[model samples]
Target chain A: MALLEVKDLKVRVEEREILHGLTLTVNEGEIHAIMGPNGSGKSTLSHVIAGKPGYEVTDGQILFKGEDLLEMAPEERAAKGVFLAFQYPVEIPGVTTMNFLRTALNAQRKARGESELMVPDFLKKVREVSKSLNIPQDMLKRGVNVGFSGGEKKRNEVLQMALFEPSLCILDEMDSGLDIDALRIAADGVNALHSPKRAMVVITHYQRLLNYIVPDVVHVMSKGRVVKSGGKELALELEESGYTQFEDAA
Target chain B: MNVAVAKTGSGRAVSDLFASAEGRLPGSPSVIASRREAFETYERLGLPHRRIEEWKYTDLRALVGEVLPLAAAPDAAALKRAADAVKAHAIAGARKLVLVDGVFAADLSDVRALTAEAGFRTLRETLEKDAGLLTTASTDAVIALNAAMATDGVVLSIADGAQLSAPIQIIHIATAASASAFTRSQVVIGKGARATLVESFVAAGAKAYQVNDAVIVTVGDDADVAHIRLMDDAPDAVNVTSHFVTVGANVKLNFFNMTTGAAVSRLQGLITLAGEGSELSANGVNLLQKTEHGDTTLVVDHAVPNCVSREVFRAVIDDRAHSVFQGRIIVRPDAQKTDGKMMTRALLLSDEAEADNKPELEIFADDVSCGHGATSGALDDSLLFYLKARGLPEKQAQALLIQAFVGEAVEQIADDGLREHVIGIAERWLERRS
Candidate 1:
């Protein structure tokens, strides 16, 4: 069975249709990169899957682990092991990174009928995870994403993704606004989280990020639909040839 | 030609209250004369209405339709209830000066310990000897009414160059229902003295009561003061508080006010920087729910040069609650090099909830750098979605965002314990909301 199956998904936001019959499928242990030109509806697909508000699902269905994913709330989708790494992580001025992580983790645990992590255990786990990501302890002490550099915000998102350990992860333009070093660090973090039990959808316009994460399959999106799907070589092919052909074909 | 002013029902009630309670009220002949003069001022002004610019957002004449009679002096049972109320609202490690039903409760306060450090006298005692305490030059109707009707309050004087070790908690507890309590207190921090003062309004076995409380604080030169006001009245109570503060040269003042429990309340702060090189950090938070109405109006006056003042106020309105914030920063012509910035933000949780934010700046000094901003908004969709996507339910996510919203202002509290205490109150409010 597929980990995530989107069958002819049509979505509209604010009376304008953004996703026109987009279809995709993901299996466990797979890393799929969705490459597209601007206005390809790549982000719309990710946000729709994550159950973000303001998007109306006009047609089709989303199945997660053989269950209707569209029927669940965003948090429910999260507790069911689905995560979306935001393209532009918001700056929450008063919520500390540590507090946010703890609240999110505990909330998910409780929703899954699991006991909450004790304070000491939670602290130890956070410290270990943050250290591996090279995040300073002081950064975690500060407000979530507030005053964080581009790299730090990306790293923080990756940290959340790692801690949540979802079954399906969606990275939305994670490589944008990052320099080479910062991109490498963020990509490394993503790469380290790959597991046979998890599936990932990496959405980006640039193939430069695929060089680090190394997707198993590449899908080219154009005009709200997947116009092409091929092996990993498709990413390098498109990067070299540009998205003009795909855009024209769609 | 003098036009006759017709008194509203509340105004007439208040006048009759003073007429009936005058004989029983405390103070000597001179004090009585001062009270009569203040009452005349109140008669002239009547209850402030919506037409008054300062009371534009809050109309006392309408909201306070009928004034309750003065609360009787607390009896033995009432005192017992007030004792329990103090335990609930008291900040740990702080010496308490308690007032029950508008009169000082020395037995419940740390009077002996506090007296050892500073001069401690009730307004009842001070008014007996000196009428000057009640003579405030201001024409504000509420202050004048308080001057006319105030029964008992603390009159504390910290000697020059004295440094108190523990924070002072002035706990006002109401123990009667359908009654009013008008109390006025003053604190004089001598030159170079350091103190932390916390004024809390709570209730024990009280409902539908009214509280009109005022406090005057004078910080001497080089003194450092942290004044925190927490109002958690009964669910159906009406509370009005006035803070008159004067900061002297080279003084540091951190002021914070949090209102969570009152059904209808207004906290007005008139802070004046009278001396040079003073810094004032004023922060406030109003967490209102249901049909509650909470307003915080502040006037920060920079009377001298080289003073810096910052005001941050946050209001979170839920259900049909209404929250208003009015902040004005005035820089006098001679107050050059003054840096004053004021920001007020309101978060409306429900469609029916209302928030009014008005920020004004009156600057006569060309060299002064002054700015004011006001913003009213609901929770950010993107921020909320981010939190929800991370596994927080909608309610939990909203709570987190609201906490973060008010946390900016609450963080200005200088002491860690006090800050946490304020946060705890906010958390409990959130819990009740959920």
Candidate 2:
């Protein structure tokens, strides 16, 4: 069986249908890039898959590892190895990054019936992962995402992704605000986490991000459904032609 | 109800209570006269109601109907209970002065240890010998009532250039089943002196109790002081506390108060920047649940030039609890270059939970800078979703956000140990809510 199977997924937000009868399948160790214009339901798809509030799945079946995904809460889905790197990362004041990271890691661990991680071990892992991302030691002591530059925010997201180590990772507009250096660093972090047992879905507006983190399969989404699917070259063709042809096809 | 009936009932009751205990009250001749004058003032003022601008949100006439009778002295059993209470609330590296059932419990306190190194005197003894402490320029009716009915308290003075190695704690524990306690304390910090003073009002296996407490402090030139008060009385307790502070030139003062366990509480603070280049940072946190009602009223007066004051307060209320914050900043005409800012935020966790925040700024100086802001809100949905998406359960996520909300104010504490101690109290409150 595939790692994730979405059969006729129909989702609505605020009484308006956003994802209309969409179906998709992803095998293990696969990277699926969904490229589309603004308001084409790309971010909505990721949010619904992550069980965000206010998005009602009117009719659908989202199976992850042969279990119903839509039946779980957001935290439950996270514990079951699903993660969504938000398009707009929230800035929570007064909550240090180290505290947030530890709480989240322990919560997921507890849900999986594992003992809580010791402080020393946890700090060691954080120091190692943060060093790779070039996240300064002082930033970890500051409030979560507070006063962070655009690049810092995106890099922090990547750091969380690395720490959580989710099996099914969804990066929503992860490259929107990053410079070339930050984009490369974030892509490196994402690339480092790719494994045979993991699956990823990278959602973006432009094709610039795909240059650093290559995708195996690229899908063109217009309106609320995937209009076309092709190899990685599809991103190149769409980048050259723009989304007009895909809009016309839809 | 008619205004006359409303005013005369409780007013007459208090007047009769004070008249009956006139000679029996402990004090010098001057102290006795001050108590009579204070009771007369209380009679004229009656219980502050909605008509009073300062007591608009907190109507004592409605919330607190009749004051309970004075609490009697604690016996051996009650002393034992207070001792246990002290142990539970003991802060590491602090001298403890425990008050059991309205009177000083020397056996339950660390009086000898504190007296050896610092200036310490029981308030009752000081009142007997000297009545100068009973005088004040301000005419606050509640303070008058405290002065008139105070049973006992502590008088502490730190010498010039003396840096205390640890904190000095004053713990007020009520052991009576259904009684009230009125206590007053005064602390003097001399020039170049530094110290930390902690006060806590908690009940020892009591119900339907009341506490009327007041503290007056004077900070000398170039002195530094940190004062923290934690009020965790019984769930059915009615608590009222007033603090008056005067800061001298180049003085640094940090004051913090947290209320979590009282059913009906009103904490009032009045601070004056009496000298140039003084800095006053005040903050408070209120964690209320069930049907509790908590109010905090603060006034920061920048009476001198080149003074800076910042006030931040946070309230987290759940169930049917209500929280009120009234903060006022006043800059006098000659107080140029004064900087004052006040902010109060409230987080309501339930539909019925209510928060009322009123921030006022009165700037008479053209060159001064002053601002005030108030906000009432629920947990940010986006923030909550972010936490939940990171694998925290709903309860844990909410608790983390609430802690962070109140943590901003608690961070104002300058001392590391005191900050963590307050945070620990906050964490326990959150645990109870969860």
Candidate 3:
């Protein structure tokens, strides 16, 4: 069975429909990329899967590990190993990064019916992961995402994903606002988290990010649904065609 | 439409009690005269009502219902109850000065632990000979009433250039039910001296009790003083406290007040920059729940040049509770080069909860930089969702955001230990609610 199965999903936000009859599937150990233009509902798909509020799934079924995914709360879905890296990370004042990460990790552990990680052990793991991401230890002491550069915010997202170790990872425009060097660093972090039992769905507007974290399959999404699905070479084909023909087809 | 103001009989009750307790209250010959004058003023003004602009949010006459009988001297049982209350709210590494039933408890308090440069005496003892120190420094009606009815408190004096190693804690415990306690205290810091003073008020099995308290502080030139007040009385207690402070030249004053208890409570601060180059930061937090009404009002005056003052306040209200913050800054014409800023924010946790924030600035000096802001809001839904998405349950997410909301103002504490201590108290408050 596939790790995630979406059957003809239709989502409405504020009484206005955004995702219309979209369906996709992801198996374990496979990396799938969804390429689309602006307002193509790519981010909406990621948010719906993560159980964000205000997005109603009108007619669809989302099955994760053969269980109904829509019925669980956002935090429950997180514990069930569904993670979505936000495109625009929020800055929360007065909440230190270290404190937020610890609370989140322990909460997830508790939801899974497991004992919480000890403080000393948690600190050791955090320090080890943050060092490789080039995030200063002092930054962890500061407020979460406060005074952080765009690159720093993206790197922090990767750090959280690594710590949570989600079974299904959805990266929504993670390459936006990152320079060449930062891009490589973030890609390396994602590559390190890749495992045979874990699946990833990468959604982006351009094919540039695919060069670093290459995917086995790429789907062309437009007008609220996927129009085409092919191998990695299909990304290069669309990059050369500039998505104009795809827009016409939609 | 016309509204008829009802003649409240409760206001007359307060005046009647003062008239009956006049000669019986403790005071010297001169102090007796002052008390008579203060009582006349209280009678003329009556209890402040919603008609008054300053007391619009907190109508003393209406909310107080009826005047509580004056608290009598504590007996052996009452004293034991107060001692137990003191032990529960004690702060670590501080010299304690306990007051039971509004009278200083000698057996419970110890001043010998204080440094040699400090001199301490009871206010009742000092009032026996000299009444000049008990003179009224504020024009507020409730404050004048406190001055007239105050029975016992502490008079602490620190010598010049003395830096006390430990903080001084004045613990006020109430053991009487359906009664009132009035206490007055004063602290005088000499030139270049340093000290930390903490005032905590708690109750032991008291219901519908009333407490009227006052504190007067004078910071000498180049001196540093930090004052912290924690008010956690009985659930149905009514508390009203006033602080009068004067900051001298190049002096540093840090004042923080936290109110987590009481059904009806109000804390008023009247401060003045009496000298140049002085800096003052006054911060407060009010955590209220269930039908409680909490008010924090401040009137800061920058009367000299080259002075700076910052005021930050936060309130977290739940269940039908109401929180009020009124901050006014006045920069005199001669007070040029003054930098004054004030911000007050409130977080409402329930549908029926209410928060009223009023921040006003009156600047007559063009060379000064002064501003004020007030905001009242519920928790940000996006922030809550963000935390929840990270795996925190709904309750834990809301608690985290509420802590961060109040943490902004609590972090203004200059002393590290006091800051952490205040944060710890705030967290426990959240824990209890959740």
Best by lDDT: 1
First chain TM-score for all predictions: 0.98, 0.98, 0.98
- Residue by residue across B288-373, what tens digits does model 2's lDDT show? 99999999999999998999999999999999999999999999999999999998999999999999998989999999888888
Candidate order by DockQ, decreasing, is 1, 2, 3
lDDT of candidate 1 over B57-168, digit per residue (tens): 9988778766688888999999999999888988998989999989899889999888888889999999889777776658788888889889999999999999998899
Residue-wise C-alpha lDDT for candidate 3, range B1-434, written one tens digit per residue: 00122224445576667776665577788888888788666666666778788999999878886657778888899888888887777777878899887889987776778645588998888888877666765667788778778888989998888898888999999999998898999999999999999899888887889999988888999999888998888879999998888889999888889998889999998899999999899999999989999999998999999999999999999999999999999999999999999999989999999999988899899899999888888898888888988999998999889888988778867778777777777777777683
Best by DockQ: 1
- For all the candidates, what are their Cα RMSDs to the real structure? 2.2, 2.1, 2.7
lDDT of 3: 0.88
- How many Å off is the CA of B176 in candidate 3? 2.6
Task: Tell me which of candidates 2 and 3 scores higher on DockQ.
Answer: 2
CAPRI quality band, candidate 3: medium
Q: Rank the candidates by lDDT, best first.
A: 1, 2, 3
Pick by TM-score: 2 or 3, better one: 2
> Which interface RMSD values do the candidates have, in the order shown?
0.5, 0.5, 0.6
Per-residue lDDT of model 1, residues A1-250, tens digit only: 5899999999999999988998899999999999999888999999999999889999999999999999999999999999999999999988999999999999999999999989999898888888888999999989999999999999999999888889999999999999999999999989899999999899998889998999999999999999999999999899899999988898
DockQ of 3: 0.75
